[model samples]
Target: MNPITLEGPRLTFRELREDDVDALFEIYGSEVATEHLSFDPRPLDSVASVIASGIADTQVDPRTVYALAVTLKEDPGLIGYARLALEAHRAGQIGFALNPSVWGQGYGTETVRLLLQLGFDQLGLHRIWGARSPKNAASARAMSGNGMVEEARIRDHVFTHGAWRDSITHVILEDEWRQPER
Candidate 1:
């Protein structure tokens, strides 16, 4: 897990680099893209620090966070951010955000699958779950399409944009996951 990399048909999840600031800012700093995420649009200057932290997370003894840069196979540029944070009992929570330019395509689903692969396939995790804002229908569909069932609603789960928002969680157990057709 020192240097994470996961590839799919159209996308690749690789370790974040310091140079990814501008690309990541395109997604993290977009109001439309982060509308339902846990935080408001981030400042450009802050994105560098985020990348730095992700790079640092990789060097930890027992890595619990995989904050990856989602790049297309054809273009080796960061277009999205994908995260899988490990928890107790062999569980992990996934989260992702893509550049608004790629919203209509199916990359979101692929990103989720790649993260699942990293957790369940590579890390031997027992369960993987993701939480999305109640209003993010696209995220709901993406997670469900990957066999992650809508499990619960956490009240006041996050306080973002100056308000308490609830989150809908979707989960899939190791036994329930079927590897994507190779």
Candidate 2:
């Protein structure tokens, strides 16, 4: 599949490259930035590994995951990244992160909407889902903004930052997504 370029008012999404390793490491290495992610702050040794893994995963499982870089079209700075990953039974999961400086400006919502379109329209996915810790109000809002409905709250589903946090699952089905408003 060709790389995707998703645009919004303030951000653009494009496929990541090997050259992005340094920038990715800068953002992903920070404890504050990586706080809510499934993985902990990335290790120095894993920088190359991460980039390679993303590329390899996309090639080996095009239907499973596509990792993309998020940047400002004007300045072209690598601010963050996003991923659309196919889950079991043809469902998809969306995840992303942006530089702390860009939070609250609506980039996350826009990027996610584009991924949902790609998942449902282009990839023929049956459903798309997202999950986050309850404390991450901003993430929850972003997911809801893209038409995802709260499906369930998996209590103590994950251990992070020395605590067991509930994972709130949100999903939008293909039929539900076809509504006029969406």
Candidate 3:
């Protein structure tokens, strides 16, 4: 598959590259970045290794995961990443992260919108879902802002920061997405 480049008002989404390791490290290393994520902050070496592994995995199985580098249109610097992992029966899971410095700037919403369009239109995915810690109000809001509806609340779904946390699961179906705006 060709590398996909999605442009929004302030940000762009493209394929991740080896050169993105440093920027990705910076984003993933931030405490805010790990706030709702499953992982914790770690050394740059470990972060680089993870990025390398993801790149290698994509090379091996293009349909397994489509990881995109989020960048600003003006500066064109790597801010973070958005990914969609294919699951069974034409369904998929969507996820994203951004540098805290760019938080509240609507980049997350734009990235997710583009990703959903690609998943439904290009990838022919029937259903796309996302989940986040219930405590992560920002992420929950971002998901809602991008047309994802809360499907369920998985109680005590994950353990993080030394405690079990509830997870808010959200999903957007292709037919729902095709509806015209009110």
Q: Quick one: best lDDT, which candidate?
A: 1
- What is the per-residue lDDT of model 2 for residues 132-167, given as tens digits with 9 covering 90 to 100? 988778888989998898999999888777778889
Off by over 4 Å in 1: 179-182
lDDT of 3: 0.83
Off by over 4 Å in 3: none
lDDT of 1 by residue, 1-182 (tens): 57887899999988999999999999989899989999999999888889999999998889998999999998879999999999999999999999999887999999999999999889999999999999999999999999999999999999998899999999999988964542
Task: Provide the TM-score for each candidate, comma-separated.
Answer: 0.96, 0.90, 0.92
Clashes of each: 0, 0, 0
Query: Model 3, range 85-117, lDDT digits (tens) per residue?
Result: 899999999989998888888888888888898
- What value does the lDDT take at residue 44 in candidate 1? 92
Total backbone clashes of candidate 2, pairs 3 or more residues apart or in separate chains: 0
Candidate 2: regions farther than 4 A off: none
RMSD of each: 1.6, 1.8, 1.6
Give model 3 RMSD, 1 decimal: 1.6
